[model samples]
Target: MTDMVEAPSGSGWKLLAPVRRAEGWLASVPAALPLLALRLALAVPFYKSGLTKWDGFLQLSGGAQFLFGQEFKLHVFGAQYPYPFPTAAAYGAGTAEIVLPVLLVLGLGTRFAALALLIMTAVIQITVPEGWANFHLPWAAMALTLAVYGGGALSLDRLIGLGREKM
Candidate 1:
């Protein structure tokens, strides 16, 4: 026997029939595409940003250093605080922006990568509070979704039997 449940007959049900059909169609769509898309979407921005942070292999760019050491500040309760150990912060951020996004795109250690990016997104929000509506919110949402959902069947996580849950 099929597990599908039929909606009761009524005007409201008639109105919702198309929606139900659409829902069914959506259900038929494979989870892999969306999961892969999510991974790529989240990876692109961070990967691009990471590219700008380095001038040479393992070398932090002057612009990145200047921004972290002098320009970027943590906003808290109407107060702005400079980042402590700014050089270390810059290096750490630069490295993570590269490494984590690569892991996310490859779906290797996907949950951990997503969680790291989510944390980075949170820190970015604190640093650039005004970007919440435009950039930070979307990044956080994507990261959170990936973190919770895990990489799907298309992922290394699944191939390696890491995140056994389907996206």
Candidate 2:
């Protein structure tokens, strides 16, 4: 013998099965998906800029020097940065471009990486408001998203249990 039970229409419990299953499935996904995308989105332009500027790591080609010497300036800073300063700035920017992306992709220290990139994006926007239409705006948007939302479900932060939301 067996017992049978019936539920009223639109009780809503039926709809929960798939949702619960999906939620459970989603929990296993690595936290790096969105973060990786944002990382790549953020990294590419700077990587290309780095590449076109120099063939070797940290080696500034003539075009890079020309750009730093002539085009790059801190208009908002209201002060002229002297020699060795531009190279310093360039090195910092280039290093961030290369290194931060890897960290973001790895989902390690994601918030910090996103914050760094966000700062860089803000500086670019401020330094060249004219270029906002092209690169700076998009970079800022992506960086800000990662800065807020973090590395998502597929990441080292989540894997090692560091980035998980606190109870």
Counted clashes in each candidate structure: 0, 8
Identify the candidate with maximal lDDT. Answer: 1
Cα lDDT for residue 118, candidate 1: 94
Please give, for residues 1-167, the per-residue lDDT of candidate 2 as tens digits.
Answer: 11165544674966866776788778766555556778677767766665676658678677667666677766566664433477767667767777787787787877788889888877776667688878877888887877777776677887887676321
* C-alpha lDDT (0 to 100) for residue 106 of candidate 1: 81
Per residue, candidate 1 scores C-alpha lDDT tens digits across 1-167 of: 12368768889878976786888889888887788899999999999999999999989999999999999999998999999999999999999999998898889999899999999999999999999999999998899888888888888888888977644
Worst-scoring 10-residue span by lDDT in model 1: 1-10
lDDT of 2 at 163: 78
- C-alpha-based local distance difference test score of model 2: 0.71
